[model samples]
Target: MNKKQISILGCGWLGFPLAKHLISKGYKIKGSSTTVSKKLMLAEAGIQPYIFKLGEDNNQEIYDNFLSESEVIVINFPPRRIPDIINIYQEQIRSILPHIKNYQKVIFVSSTSVYQNTNDWVTETIDNKPEKDSGKAVLAVENLLKSHSKENLTVLRLAGLIGYDRVPGRFLANKKEVANGQAPINVIHQDDCIGLIDAILKHNSWGEIINGCADNHPLREEFYTLAAKKANLTPPEFKKSETIQFKKISNTKSKALLNYNYKYPDPLILVR
Candidate 1:
């Protein structure tokens, strides 16, 4: 079978590695970055790189050329957290939506933050009531894609990404007082995240909202204490709170829908 050409928008942390992995498997990958420096970086990794920005002033001709030869397009940028940023994000992505019509698949890298802390298990079926700026931005973008893509979008709401240089222990290593220590953490290893994306493309599973997370939900205190210890950092102290605002994110849907198992099922083991 001939490999499908994929265009990756915002080829940063996760997207860059995914592009490289796909390339090794005989897929032709075209990646884009906002910085000119990344052009050489992507090219060095065998990706055809393009530099462009999304917004009302976007150059249609440039985006058309970038999206022209691609069978798949991955929208992999994190939503802006600043206030009044959703409109900007919407403009950016919606501007590119016109050019993605010919693509067979459109995968949007989203976040579990879109789901509010309901003190219960959250799934794709639950209504999204985002509680923060970042969550609001992501949820808004997800809606835009869902409404305009004619059901051709795949939204992967990934958990707290813990891998490579982004280990969780270092997050609260020197922190004095941390809130929500008893809250359950929904985190996924970077390796499993990439694996799930690969599985989705292989299975041709589009038109779905999937929660890309791990099977285990450990308490924040226990998980972070260990993560800090492993990194040889000062462990954080959790207040003695009687109330626990916690939610355990279930990966049952991702496992069932994608037929995938997480390599980092136990986050406590990540402390090592």
Candidate 2:
């Protein structure tokens, strides 16, 4: 049996790590970066790096080649702050969809922000009423891929990603008066992010939306304070305020269906 070729769009941060892991697992990786400088790094990591700018000129041929050659495609691009980011994403999807016709699988990396802040528990069955601009745009792209793609599509709605050098303690190391200290914080480590994708691919799971978040939700103040203490910094203060509309995200579907276990189940465990 031949190894599968995987193409990762927007190979930065999470995408780059995913591509690297896939390569190490004996899959051929073709990754895209808008910046030309990143090509060298991708090449060094044994990835066939392609320079693909979403809105740039004369780049359709490159994207088409990538889409046609890869057996699986992962779209991990973030929306830019254009006046009509949703429309732009739609256009990009339309452009790429044609080339990915023969691909066996497609993974759309989406955000948990697609859920409206409702101060309740949210699951895959909940109607996605995105409250933020970026969330709305992500939801639009997800719908476009789900409705139009002929291939099996898997949508992974990830919580705030944290790993590598991007730990939360640095975010609040010296800050004071952080809002909503008592509000529960939801996050997933990058290792688990890649692990979830690995599980989905290994099982050939598709045509489903899975919430890719850790099982734990700690009060913001407690997590941040512990993070501060670990980093040898003073814990920031939190003032009690009116609760913003937010919900505890449910990962039951991901757990049941994929049989996936999160490596970092607790938010505070990462700091300790």
**Candidate number achieving the greatest TM-score relative to the actual structure:** 1
List, residue by residue over 1-272, the lDDT tens digit for candidate 1.
Answer: 99899998989889999999999889999899989888899999999989987763757888888888788888998876666877777877888887877445899999998988899999899988888878888899998888877467899989999899898878998886788988989999988989999988998999998998888888999999999898889999988776788667888988999999999998888886
Model 2's TM-score against the true structure: 0.93
Instruction: Give the local distance difference test score of model 2.
Output: 0.84
> How many residue pairs clash in each candidate at the backbone level?
0, 2
- Model 2: per-residue Cα lDDT over 143-169, one tens digit each: 888777635899999998888878687
Measured against the true structure, the TM-scores of the candidates, in listed sequence, are 0.96, 0.93
lDDT of 1: 0.87
